[model samples]
Target: MSQQVQAVIAPGENEPVRVETIIVPDPGPGEAVVRIQACGVCHTDLHYKQGGISDAYPFLLGHEAAGVVESVGDGVTDVAPGDFVILNWRAVCGQCRACLRGRPWYCFDTHNARQRMTLASTGQELTPALGIGAFAEKTLVAAGQCTKVDPEVSPAVAGLLGCGVMAGIGAAINTGQVGRGDSVAVIGCGGVGDAAIVGSRLAGASKIVAVDIDDRKLETAKSMGATHTVNSKETDPVEAIRSLTGGFGADVVIDAVGRPQTYRQAFYARDLAGTVVLVGVPTPDMKLELPLLDVFGRGGSLKSAWYGDCLPSRDFPMLVDLHQQGRLDLGAFVTETIGLGDIEQAFGRMHGGDVLRSVVVF
Candidate 1:
């Protein structure tokens, strides 16, 4: 039997999100229904509402989530009912070319529940944010999307590993490959950038400089293990970063803001042959122009991090265990907890830069 549950949804472009009852059907083969414990409000959710992601109206908007596996359908063997798990967007298919090459994290074919969630009032099928609509009390997803972890970890903290937190950490460790004693500079001191700082510290980077336009965020970045701070709004960040790195520049510079200006700053702010990682999302119409000579002269990698290029199965459990062992401060990223009804208010608070994340808790 189908069950009705309240969920946060954007009815149309630029519309405010509201709690509406939606129909969740029983899981089919390879699917699972989760009883959501917590879900984080992410910028991607805002993008979905603004139609930045697509013109898919009536979007079910939440992805950074953790929950208990309430039930599983036929062919689901990895997770059972009552298991604590973090929901991921990428459920890799082993047959894909990337998976065939042993890089399942880059699997071209990720999985989502084949069933459709419908709005009870109009029977309109809703598009789930990131294919994992998790704003509701219960959500259906592919069994492969659920990565079981320590049930002892707080759901709010564990939920973060579902998206932004994992992206930042992976941006450093998996993509940028920041090593021990390497100097790293992260542009943008938001939750993702701060996570990059945490990852850099964990990797034993001797100098981690955090760059942000907001002084408050810079201070918080310090708490997240930033060894140096740069107020990009007040000073030329490239010069500041270079000055901090003994005029040679950092080994790795990550642009968490994802703008032309920031990318250019990241371009010139690194030492010769130093890697530059672009982790921040860019608008579709956004374009970049760099001097060809400069690109050749830089002589290093310029890479974009898609969800930090993470493998949910390998990364989620290790990160949760690290947090449980008092090494990773996952709790610091959660600034406040709100109910599903408070999503609009939380969206308003997102730009304030003080709140790292406003999580929706059931």
Candidate 2:
């Protein structure tokens, strides 16, 4: 049976997102239907609305979500009805070259529901934001997209593990490989940057410096485990970071802001043979200019982290357990909770830097 539910949709480029009736069809082979309990308002959703992601219009936006499994199609043995799960965009196909090489996290072929969700009034197929359209009351997705976790955790916090939170943490722990006593500097104290601080602390980093223009966000970074904060507006962050690390740049510098200037800051703010991780998404028109000699002289890796090189099956459950044990503070990331119709308002708040995350709770 096809279920008609209220969902948020971006009808066209630069159009405001609004709630409308949409038809979610029954799961086909290797698919599942989820009743979403909570979904976070991420910048990626905003990018989709602005047509920065693709030409796909009338996008069903929202991907960072947690919910209960309502039903499953044939051969969907990983999850069943009534199970609690976190929605993920990466659904690894074991036969892919990346997966066969034992790096399933880089799986080239990810799974999404074959069936399309259509607008109720127009009968037009709606493109999902990132293969998972989760702003709706109920959503259809690939069975592999559902990662089961303990039902005891709050859906708002757990949903974040699906996207930005995971990306930030993974940038520090998985991609940057922050180790004990290492000095780490994260540029941009947004949700992603703050998560890098927390992840660095969790990995036993001795000096964690956070750089951002907003003093309020810097304060929040301290609460998330930053040992020092640098207001980039007041001082040169590269010099500040170097001064804090005994006048030798940090062992690892992560650029979360993803602009040309920040990228250069991150490049120059690392010690010789130190790693620089670029986790920030850059615009297509942006061009980077670096000295070829410096690239050779730096002598360390310059890597771009895709989804933080994360393996969902391994990271999600472990992080949830850490949250349960009270070792990780997942709740700190959620600043507020809004309703389905309030996505536009939440986007404005995000743009204004008033909140880290404004989750929509069902």
Candidate 3:
């Protein structure tokens, strides 16, 4: 039987998304249908509407989401109906080379739903954003994509682990390897950057500096665990970071903005033999042309964090538990909550730096 779901669909480039009735199929083998409770309005969704991610028009736009499994198809085992889960884009194929080598985080093959969700009226195939479109009442995903977690926390908060939150925290804990007494610097105090700051604090970093052009976001960063804040608009961040780190620089500098300028600042703002982690999503036109000697002179790893190098099965539940225990501030990241129809306005708010995350609550 087909399920009728209210989905946010971007029919063409730069077009406003419409909430339309979409036909969701019964789950196929290894697939499960989740009744979405909440989905965050991330920048990626806006990018999809702008034709930045792909030319696949009539795209079902959403990814960061959490919900309860409504049904399961044949051969599904990891999740069953009634289980609460956070949807993950990277459903690791354990038999892949990266997984075989014991690094499932870099799984070469990830899984999505076998069938496509389409427009009910036109029967037009709608490409799902990041393979998990959860702006609807229900969406289909691979069984492996649903990572079960505690149901005590609101889905509005738990769903965040599906994306940006995971990216920020994982960037610090996984890519940066921030440790006790380490000095860490995060550029761009958006949701991801703030999450990095929180992660740094969680990892026991002694000094966490947050750099941003906006004073308000910097202040929020302070609340999230940034020991110091730099208004990058009025200051040279690289120099400010060095001053804060005793004229050396932070042991780790993260470019959460993912621009050439911010990346350059992060590149030059780290202490010798320190790491520079890029977790921000950059546009294709944006290019970095730093000196070759600088890359070698740094003497530390230059890494790009993909979804914060997170293993959904390992990180989501643990983080959810942390949130439940009040160890992590997942709730703090949610600046505002709205219905699915508010996504387009939420995109504007995101662009205007008005909110950290505008979650769509079903």
- The alpha-carbon deviation from the true structure for residue 84 of candidate 2, after best TM-score superposition, in angstroms, is 0.4
lDDT of 1: 0.94
| TM-scores, each model vs. reference | 0.99, 0.99, 0.99
What's the lDDT of the predicted structure labeled candidate 2? 0.95
Write down the TM-score for model 2. Answer: 0.99
| lDDT measured at residue 328 in model 2 versus the true structure, 0 to 100 | 93
Stretch of 10 with least lDDT, candidate 2: 299-308
Per-residue CA lDDT of candidate 1, range 244-335, in tens?
Answer: 99998999999999999999999999999999999999999999999999999879899988889999989999999999999999999999
By lDDT: ranked, best first: 2, 1, 3
lDDT of 3 by residue, 58-88 (tens): 8999999999999999998888899999999
Q: Report the error of model 1 at residue 249, Å.
A: 1.0
Query: Clash number for every model?
Result: 0, 0, 0
- State the displacement of the C-alpha of residue 271, model 3, in Å, after optimal TM-score superposition: 0.5
